[model samples]
Target: MTDPISIVSTAMAEDTLRINTIGNNVSNVSSVGFKAQTLSSKGDVHSDLINNSDGRLLRTNRKLDLALQGTGFFVVDNNGQQLLSRNGSFSVNESGQLVTSNGKFLVQGRSGPINVGIDSFSIDSKGVIWVGDREVDRLLIKQPNDSMLLATAGNYSSASSREVKDGYVVYQGALESSNVDVAGEMVQLMAAQKHFSLMQRYFLLYDGLMKNGINQIGKSK
Candidate 1:
């Protein structure tokens, strides 16, 4: 027989994880180019697995900022390692190189980071950088179909391999808003709370049943 306390504890832990996800979504509601992360809860084993996908775009007319119209990610150097992001909140670095808000260098092509040679430039739908007369570099873009695509920090990779769209469009002068909705999160919070309460009631009933069983045994004795 399952222990009543153990069952309750496990249920509570899962509920707590769900609440944490809701909280994170609410917190990043205003983050630029921030995609909403989802918590996938099945039977019990993979309780709080998170899924990160690109969100819908919001138009903010600002130069230096960019957003992808379809399946593509902005390449960035998070310190030394490269990272991918849908957040097009980019700006010129101190060296006048195009970079993310956190100063990560944007990746290009199949080799390394793309160099924005000029002091100013523009990007087209095909992600070709136009610095006056020269096409500097094409942005590195990828599209994955299944669980093989592992999102590390913000970069994605897979063993089976995913195809990349080297010429995807990039909208200059705009930033994508987070896909999170406060109202939706609130609804989710209520549902999770009600379910947790129901589980708690079930746990209490099981405990009472075990106690009554012991009492009946004692009386028979």
Candidate 2:
């Protein structure tokens, strides 16, 4: 028979992982464009992270902020590596190039890096950027064939294959709120904690049984 102690220990480890994941979700509940992650069991021991991208839109009413209303992501050049994100909070850098709020990654446009040049610009529903009367560029919005295949880090996701998605409407002066359900997470966390406690009790019970059996053998000798 398989050792009960080993089985209990494995269950405890899995519980710890689940609690940590729930904690992370709760912490990022207010992060802009953040997606909630859920752990799906693969077989008996392994699990996979599935990100939920169904977040609600928040109106910021700031011209520089942007938001998507449908299935698509804004493309950003992260040091030559293109990354996709729903985070539309952007600002112009020192060189007049549009970048993320952190002033790190450059926001990509149809031509290349967008340079607003300190001029007031407006983005239409179709992702077109207009500076005064002339149209400068359009934002790069793409949707992957399978969003689950992309690796997610915070509000950004990256994949090798990119396909331009024109089905989405871009809403300027808004952002996407995180999709984390705090109440649901709290319920799951409580269940995991209870399971962990039961597993710990089983472990202690097995240890005591082993000790008792060894003591009986010593008495016989």
Best by TM-score: 2
Global lDDT scores for all candidate models: 0.67, 0.82
Query: Using Cα atoms with residue i matched to residue i, what is each candidate's TM-score against the true structure?
Result: 0.78, 0.89
Clash counts for the predictions, in order: 2, 0
Collision pairs in model 2:
none
Evaluate model 1: give its lDDT.
Answer: 0.67
The local distance difference test score of model 2 is 0.82
Q: Best-fitting candidate, measured by lDDT?
A: 2
Q: Per-residue lDDT for 92-144 in model 2, tens only?
A: 99999999998888999989999999999999999999999999999988765
In candidate 1, the residue pairs with backbone N, CA or C atoms under 3 Å apart (3 or more residues apart, or in different chains) clash, namely 33-176, 125-169
lDDT of 1 at 208: 94
Which 10 residues in a row give candidate 1 its minimum summed lDDT?
153-162
